[model samples]
Target chain A: MIAAAEPIEPAPSAGAPIDEAEALRRLRQNEDQSAQYYAAWWLGRMRSRNPEAITLLCQALGQRQPRQAEAGVEHNAVARNAARALGKLGQAEAIPHLLQALDDPDDGLREAAARSLGELRAMEAVPVLCTRLASGPDVAGAPQTASSRLQEPCEAMLEALGEIGLAEPRLLAVIESFVAHERPLIRSAACRALLQLTDDSHWGQQLLALLEHPQLQVRRAALMDLGAAGWRPALEPIRRTLAENSLKLMALRGLVENPAGPHATRLDEETTALLAVMDELL
Target chain B: MLSPNPMAAEPTELIRALRQADSPMGLLLATRQLAEACHPGAAPSLVEVLGFNNPGAAVAAVDGLIALGEQAVEPLLANLDDHNYGARAWAVRALAGIGDVRGLELLESALACDIGPSVRRAAARGLGQLRLDALPRSEQTRLRQRCLDALLAGGGDGEWVVRYAVAVGLEQLLLGMDRAEPGHRSGLKALQELAGEPGDDTPVVRLRAGLALSRLAGGAGG
Candidate 1:
């Protein structure tokens, strides 16, 4: 009995265990630069874990930075992280601050904002993402210390909206425009996003047409999407493009998944033939 | 030959280990092996690894990030400026494999600055693989020039495989240009003459001369 001493109570879960109000107050008043940074970050993280905290952060994000504003609020890694947290939280209220962040001169800040807008799945941000995509990567200012990678966040944002399966007309229009962007990578991303959105009618046909995109990647993505949609029309054209082993493998895989028996058999034959070529090359 | 099946008896252990792996390489190898076997559970862990501390480890985490292919692009792109050329090269190669072009501009930059000729060559091949040649003439020229310069720099002593690669790239550049421009004309002619006598002297010289011929032919065609 003595050895069995009462079991200790389990520690509180990380979620909402402490006094949120107290923490927020402390976070608001902490004068230490790093402390303020951590506070803002935790606030954002907490907001992400619980939607209730979103409105509060939204208001705080909207408030003008203190007199040290030029020091750059969002550039603070914490602020950037917070913006990303808000993006994950997906509250519409965070849109404006996130958009303002898009204009922030800091590439990191702008990127964080772009990523958050995407995670929120806010279709309203579609126009902004499109504009940025069109602008391409920021190559000016600050001796260009940063690489062109900041543009990936906006690309992610675009993908997020597509993956959310939102059917907003403007969103679709923006996605369509991206498909033709001067940046091949952006166009490829747009194609992938469009694939995420499978509208059996219009979107499906457009994706099917992309089978002919000059870029093999766009074509591969389109074929994959068509397969995902179980579109039968993809069989013939996909069969024709079997020149590429990778693409052919994808087309064959799609046929196997979707079940066009005769078409699948044909693909199997082509696949086998392609394997012979590949084996010889290998 | 490891398997990827999640329903296997040791699946739970593997999954747990995957979540805690310290290095991305370990995580990637385990996940890839698990995937080959039959386990789909490695996906999330793989995706999580993309956010790892080391850029190389982060890149190793990519093949398993299909759940967020597009989502992973930016993180991967950000790594292109990594202090270690290997890390930057790995990131560029991975983005190209992801083949989304979201990082094409970044890759284009890498083709110019990254130290190793192999890395630059990979970037060039990736652009061609992605058909970025179809981009505007200006962008195309930039990409082509980088590829040409890299092919020429790689040297003829490397390997026939490398030599063949340089020749292919020279051909690609010749085929990619507007053909009417003076630059294109000079480049194609230089490439054709180089390709004429395939006897390997210095791979760099042969490649460079071949690339010039290709550009010359391209310009003449235009």
Candidate 2:
């Protein structure tokens, strides 16, 4: 008979398993570029609230190492990912540093910073972001080779504004113009933003129409967009979308419920309607 | 009546350590040791350690209280300190982890609006796993609906982690409910929504909700 295998330990994560202390050390010391990058992701992923971790991440926002693959571009992947982590760490202290990063020459880092500020819901960053958005997606330093989405932080800026909820009519008008942008990605993202900013079903209708677009990727993105829009009319369209169960269910729920709202002891009308729709799927 | 046990009167190592503890480090050491001795006698000291303002010691104390199971619920309740937010947070977590239905009201309140994400997450997970069978048959349905309501409300929690925990709680609540009930239909619909696209921004939340929905289906198949 074959010998029974002994159970030892669970497999390690894709990134090497480093304890909190080690992650902090690697991040603070800039042990190596690779080590530093992984450490930044880890500290944020682990939700480490260490003041030292926050300070190191903030410092990393300015570590401008040029991308070797694209030698001419001075964008730092390390700083970009570091900005992403700081947002996840939920420290308000990083907000000022992130705002400073918003004006960085590297649009990639700027995008990451915008995303983090949105995640932080930095209300203060709104006017700054609006100014940047007003400047348009084609900033002066952007590389011509990359697509509009990759070349600028416009898409990310709009998404962040939506996350923070834009009330300024000037910024809203800028986002509204992007609804007619040539790129499908930008157009879809604009619709999502408009929905959040305006809470208008017109944006939701545009999102539903995008759900029927030729590309599968655009449809998927619209499904997510519609979900975040929380427009009541999007529910039926989301259910009918040719997507997997996970996406369908998520979009439907967002239409009826706002996660940040007060505790629900009883089912509201929207929730009742949601259940009625779900009954058909069941 | 059953005969009383003399062993209950003997001082366990946890109590002895608590008496000997003179410093913060000593208290942590005592609390850590209490993890080894999971007895009803250690419950009070474990509850006391929650107010130590030491996360390490407090974590150990919470684990010890949880390990004491249903027995620790009373002391945790009686010692509820309204003034100390940290202690209350830790205590709420411990009570939720214990899943002894007696912690229902606390779990509901914590899930509703506790400032600490971790506390709310614990409450969400705790509310779902309450031992409904422990209640009288006549009362089980009402209690189950109460749990379902809290978990459903928790589904809207802003923090993805709390919402993820809410998915877990909902799945557990679903497991306890009969498939034909109106509550089960609403609860299951909420789970489906959590699993849906753009429903939760975090992939982890969506994945967990999807996994929860899958588990419920698998359980039904069995």
Model 1 agreement with the true structure over B67-181: per-residue lDDT tens digits = 2345556655544445444444445555655556466666566555555443554455455444553478677666566555554553232333234334545555556556664
Worst 10 residues of 2 chain A by lDDT: A1-10
lDDT (tens digit, per residue) of candidate 2 on A1-282:
001111122222336688989987887776477677778888887899789999999998888676766433235967987999998999899999999999887778888899899989899899888877665544422434745335556778888888898577888887877787666667888888887877777887888898887665677778777766666677777776654333455565555454323434124445555645542221
Candidate 1, residues A1-282: lDDT per residue as tens digits?
Answer: 001111222222222444556446534553554444554555554454545456545544433333345554333554565576677665687888888877765556676676677666666666666666554433211123355444345445555566455666666666676665554445545655665564435555565566676655556556555554444555566665412323333444444444323344222344333322222110
User: What value does DockQ give for candidate 2?
Assistant: 0.02
**Model 1: docking quality category:** incorrect
- The TM-score values for the models, in the order shown, are 0.33, 0.53
Q: List where candidate 1 sits over 4 angstroms from the true fold.
A: A1-23, A44-52, A59-74, A134-146, A150-153, A163-188, A198-282, B1-222
